[model samples]
Target: MKTAADKLSPTRVKLTVEVPFDELKPAVEAATKKIADQVQIPGFRKGHVPTRLVEQRFGRPAIMQEAVNDALPDLYQKAATEAEIKPVGRPEVEITEVPGLDGKDEGDLIFTVEQDVRPEIDLPDFSALEVEVEEPTVDDDAVQVRLDQLRERFGTLVGVDRPAEDGDFVSLDMTATIEDEEIESVEGVSYRIGEGNMLEGLDEALLGLSAGETTTFTSKLAGGEREGEEASVKVTAQSVKVRELPEADDEFAEMASEFDTLDELKADLKEKAEADAKGNRVALARNALLEKLLDDLEIPVPDGLVQEEIDNHLRNEGKEPGDSHGEEIREDTVKAIRAQFLLDEINATREVSVEQSDLMGYLQQLSAQYGIEPNQFLQMLAQSGQLEQIFAEVQRSKALDVVLADVTVKNESGDVLDLELGGSEDDADADDASDDAADEAETKPAAKKADESGAAEQETAEDVKAAAKTPAKKTTTRKAPAKKAPAKKTTATKAPAKKADAADEKDAKESGEKDA
Candidate 1:
């Protein structure tokens, strides 16, 4: 066998391959046997027919076609490996010639494959790259917010006689109808007035509605058979309730936390808040550095692959292929593709690798986000053939960290910031906590939250400790962090809350829930 490659463009290649008749013999035999098993011949049992007789009955050309089709995938893979071309998306293949098609097995198998590939990238000197981020700071207001969040965890929901307001919890009975024909209904569902996770305009309609008051709104059904269809939704407030938080005193502190005094709890919250601010600064700096590289670099992206991604995105959103939103996302899609190509090249150059611990840690973080068991999440990744993709993502993140380490980052005040990208003491502690949590999860069944509106109220001190210890979501080239200066950082160099592909994450969560 032999292979040759022609450079069609910086990000595209065409490979031509030739194989001898002997290489096609095994596929030919297999194809003959397959046909024999399907055809009925007199005086011969199924699958016991002679190859020559099967060929005569099915025609030589049909046998040759089946053989070629059976062999193309492996042949193309071998040819691509030999040519050292890293194909990105699916390849367009054309079989130019096939051996044994003319009643003679003398000619060679010949074919050409056109494919998009990772482009060659020349990385700039990292030491020369510089970026500025806001100075890390923790104010009283921020600490108070954290304190309030913790307090909410122990708050009691008390029934109220007044109208529902923002931050109030409500028990609701909702029914959807089309032209007075009831389509769907749910009774006694607990919802927070301001969460906005329910139907659109629900918060607005519920506001100022007292217990037993009913209001009607027009909105599209988000799910069920009539999803996306506009309908009249009638909602009655069964009950209105307010969460009464415990006092921020020494006695309350002892009940809600490990600390015995309110001062001690506030101090710990302040320290965590400070760490969060520092993480935010590092995230900002990392984004600035990445943006600089993207702006200065010119990596060619394959138009065909871009279009395919755009079409997939639109299809996932249940929109037409030619939707105008495709155009809106085109710019982001191109940037994401370019960033992946860039980081991938860096990953190769720097010889970045994902260790077992790193992969496990990532899986644990993702599973926690989706509220599933870590082992179950790992199984889902393996079953979906996404383990490799996740590994690549981790490698890309580490590669970016390498680049960040060499770059100079400063705050707005022009002071050199000691940005701890990773491997910090806090990170190590978080990892330990996560590992412990995972072990506990494996040993015991997970406690499900009673209600989304009362999530904070259900959490214990241990949960709060784990929450404070965990870092921000790790980002990758595909899921670049927004280029905004955060009020407080969630991770040292992690991306914001959104995952790389929201749709994929949703699907994984749904599948994991079903499996559970």
Candidate 2:
């Protein structure tokens, strides 16, 4: 076999391949067998027809076409590997010539493939790059914020006769309409005033509404078939309530936490605030370093691939191919594709690899964010065929971490910050163990308390349900919303394979092929 690659553009390539007759023999035999199994012959049982008789009946050209189609994918993959080109999107394949078409198995199989590929990028020296991040510091205000958050967790919701205000929780019944025709409606939904997560102008409309009071507003629908379309929305507040927090004292500390006194609780909060500040600083530094690298490099994006992604995005949103959202999708898709290419090149250069522990840690973090059991989440990922994509993402992240380790980072005061971007394997293992131990310790006290108080289990279940409604933290890469049906007051189990599958599909829109 012989293969040659022609550079069509910075982000495109055309490969010409010639396969010897011997190389095509196996595919030919397999194709012959497949055809024989499908056809009925007078004196032969199904799938036991002679190759010569089948070839005579179907003609050599038909056999060659079948063999070519059967063997194309593997043949193209091998040729691309031999040519040393990292193809990105699907290739346009054309079979130019085939052997034995003229009743003589003399000529080699010839074909050409045109595809988009990763552009050659000259990465700048990482050691030469420098970025500044905020200094890791925990002030009294930060500690107070953490303490207040914890207090809120143990707070009780008391019914209020006054109008709803910011931070008040309200039970609401909502109805939406277009052109005086009701489009959607929901009743007895709990909403927090000023959260603004449900719809545009909802917070402002809900403010100042007392129990049994109704208000109307106009806003665009957030999702569904009429997403992005303006509609009239009416909301009725069923009841208004405000959270009454416990006093910051020894009694409150003992009831809310393991700490014996308020001072000890505050101290623990302060310590945690400090650790979070440091983690935030490290994340900021990493983002700054990545931004610097992206700015320094000139990576070409394939226009065809970008358009394909735009079409897919519109399709998924239930919009037409020429939807206005295509413009925005194109920009984001280009950036994501460029980032993927850049990280993939660095991954190859640094010989980065994903370990089993790395995958486990990532999966645990994701599962926690989505409020799903780790084992169940792993099963979902495997069922969706997204393990490989997840592995690639982890590899890219590690490659960036490798680059960050070599770069210099400083605080605003010009003091060099010792930001631990990525730690050694042993350190990672230790950190994981420490986290597990801390989680166990935290839960043990709660479990014991629950055993003492019968109603505590019901309260804990309610808390878990509330937490499940909270959105997951945003990551560098955008992910599709989990495909879980809403339950009355519990975290719904997600569909077996939609979240990761949608994400993988979105990222790899063009990572498939079609024969031309």
Candidate 3:
């Protein structure tokens, strides 16, 4: 077989291949034998039919077609190997020249294969890239806040007749109609005001409503409403309930948790929050390290990868992906492919490998989540023929994790710490300050007017603290500070006077000695 390759573009390649007639003999013979076995010939068995008779009946053109069909796989493989093309999809093969049976007995069978190949990648250094991320800081206040949430989780909801406050639960009845015909009406739906589980407006809509008041609103149905249609929802407040929080004392701590004292419980919460914060910091740092590893990466995405992904998506949905989504998915597919390449390079550099034990453990965890035994899940997977795919996914995840593990992790403090992403030391304080400031500014306009007043107050506080250690000022004049004034004058007088006395004493002794 003779072959030549042409580089069409970064993502596409063309291979022109030629196979001589003599090299195609085995394939031709096999096809003829296969046809002979299929056709019925008088006085001969199905398997024992003669090749000459079969060829004479079926004709040589049919035989040549069969031969080409049989030889395509081997020929394509050889051509790809020779051209060094990592073909991404099934090639569009065009036969340029076909063998003529009698007139030109032996000639080259030329074919042109056009297909997309894997894009070449030029990766950048990991150490050169840097990204600024908010560091994790989980302080004592955050721990206490989280502890409060945990305590509330154990507390029972009590119904009361009062205006809906921040920590109140409201019970309501709602009717959803598609076309003014009520589809479903839910009653006694107990929901927290800001949980956001229900439709977007429902929570905010329920916030101010009293126990006996009714409110009507429209919400878009989950499934597309009748092509450009919206649902009319009527919500009625059945009852307004408030959370009766237990006291935040030692007694409350003993009742709510295993801890004996409030301080101990608070300490425990702080520890938990700190641990979570550390873990988050490590995760962030790991990502940063990966970004650093992939500083100037440039890679051609494997052609057809995105389309293949879209096709796979459609396949899962039991439909073939149309050409409409081809261009749009390319952008996303390129991003995904780049990420994969970075991860792959990192894995290779670090020699990251996944263990079978880890995969089994992950599967067991998944099994537990789904409330099935590990073996039962495995059996189901085997029946579905997705067991290998699951393993491949596991391998890929473990490989990524290995890279993440080897990367650097540190908190915003630059203290070589591993902390959780959102959990931070000053988070509660920042939240509290922001909330109080905003609330005060809104409810009492005087505070917003008093921002300058607040800055002035802060300035006065600084002046008072500064003046505390310094000596008192002189009342005589508005001159420089008088505390250093006397010291300067005294040192000046004593030095000159001592020098004059020493000179006078030396002169007197010399005169008396000369007179003697």
Candidate 4:
């Protein structure tokens, strides 16, 4: 077998392959046997008939057709591997020649395959890059704010002699009636004034109401039989209370914190605030570095891949195929795909290995972030065929961590900040970042499933192997990235109060979608 590759474009390739007829003999024999078993022949047992006899009865055309059908996939795979092409979507195959149909000397089998391929990325020495992060500093006001929060937690609520106001806690009796019929009622419920945690307009109704005062307001019921229905709610303020914060002194500090004095507590709070600020600064610096890297590159993206991603994105969002901001989405998706590819290249160059422990750790983090049992989340990933994507994401993240470690990071004040790539105090919430990566996977464009044309059939063995190992998806976080990019810092988002399993039924169906 021999293969030749022609560059159709920066992101596409065409491979011409030739195979000797001898190499296809096994396939032809298999095809002949398959046909023999399905047909009835006098004086011969099923599936035991000689190949020549079957071919003589059925003619070589049918056998050749079946043989070619059975052989094309393996042949295509061989050609792709020999040519070293990373096919994205399916390939277009055309059988240009097949000799020996006339029972003469067997000649060569020839075919041409064209498909979109993963573009080659030229990665620079990312370790040499420099980025400026914000200096993590805790101002007195920030410390005071944290101190105030601590004080509020230890504060006592006292019965107030006046009407309720914002920040006041009120004990009230409430009854809901819809169309002259009572819906629900509660007695002695305590609510903080202006919290708006319950039905809308409840706070306004309670405003300026003295003890034993009654007020009626119309609002929609939040839940129950009359949910979303307008109801007249009558409320009677049973009592109003105000929060009284303890003074910031030694006694108060001793009661509220582990410190012996207010000054000690304030210093501790300031240190914590500074640490938090440092985390934030690291995230900003990482993002800035990635954004700069992406801005620096001129990577060419496949249009078909970009469009496919756009369509998938809009579809996932429950919008039409060509919704608004499609161009922006396309651009973003393209950048994301490029970033993954580039990082993958870097990961390979660095010879990064993802250990089993690393994968388990990543999944555990995701399990916590999604608020599901570890076994359950692992099952979901396996069921969806997303375990490979997750593994690739973890590898890519670690690769970025490597580059971040090598890069020089300075704060805005021109002071060098110590940034260890992994295991920094800021990484305590790295599991939160794993959630972001998973979410990004859920919304990743189908670059691997891009539209294809000009190929009669498609198969790429190398692609199958690579995909089985490294499926395409958003693998890392980025503020924005350029040609030669760096890692993005991790920022935590509030995990949903409800576990992901609550929506498992809805997600389970599409969990195995090719692109997240």
Q: Taking the tens digit of each residue's C-alpha lDDT, what string does model 4 give over 1-516? A: 989999999889988888899898888789888999998889899888887789799877667666776677677777787888776654556666764567653988776777788778777777678888767677999999998887766666678789889877777888999889999887877677765656779889988999999999998775565555789999999998776777889998898778899999999998888767765665566566666677776667677756655665454333577777677656557767666666666777885666665677677865655446789878866764455556667776666655676778887778877765545423433543344344444334432111111111123343322222111131111111112111110110112123212222222332212210
- The better candidate by lDDT, 1 or 4, is 1
lDDT of each: 0.65, 0.64, 0.52, 0.64
lDDT tens digits, residues 1-516, model 2? 999999999988988999999899998889899899999999999999998999899877777767776676678778888988766544566566677677776788777877777789898888888999877688999988987777776666678899999988777888999999898887877666765557779889989999999999998776655765789999999998887776888998898779999999999999877776765675677667766777879988788766655554454444788878778645555665566667777887896756777777766765654435689888876764545544555566667767877889999989888766556644453234323322221222111111110100111111211112111221111122333211100000112212212221221332221111
TM-score of 3: 0.57
Candidate 2 ranges with C-alpha deviation above 4 Å: 174-187, 196-205, 214-235, 351-379, 421-516
Tell me the TM-score of each prediction against the true structure.
Answer: 0.75, 0.74, 0.57, 0.64
- Of the candidates numbered 2 and 3, which has the greater TM-score value? 2
Index of the highest-TM-score prediction: 1
Query: Per-residue lDDT tens digits of candidate 3, residues 1-516?
Result: 888889998867888888998888888789888888788988899878887787678777777666666566677777888887655534566665667454245987776777666666654443343344457688767987887676554455566776665546666788778877886567766666775545547766777788878888886543222312366878887777655455678887787679899999888888878766654554455456545554555666545544544444332222445845435544544454455444544444554444555456555654443335579766765654444434433443334445443334544554443332233324332222222222222221111111110110111111211122211221110121212111000000011001112222332333211210
For each of the candidates, the C-alpha root-mean-square deviation to the true structure, in angstroms, is 14.0, 15.7, 33.2, 12.3
TM-score-based ranking:
1, 2, 4, 3
Worst 10 residues of 4 by lDDT: 485-494
Error of 2 at 279 (Å): 1.1
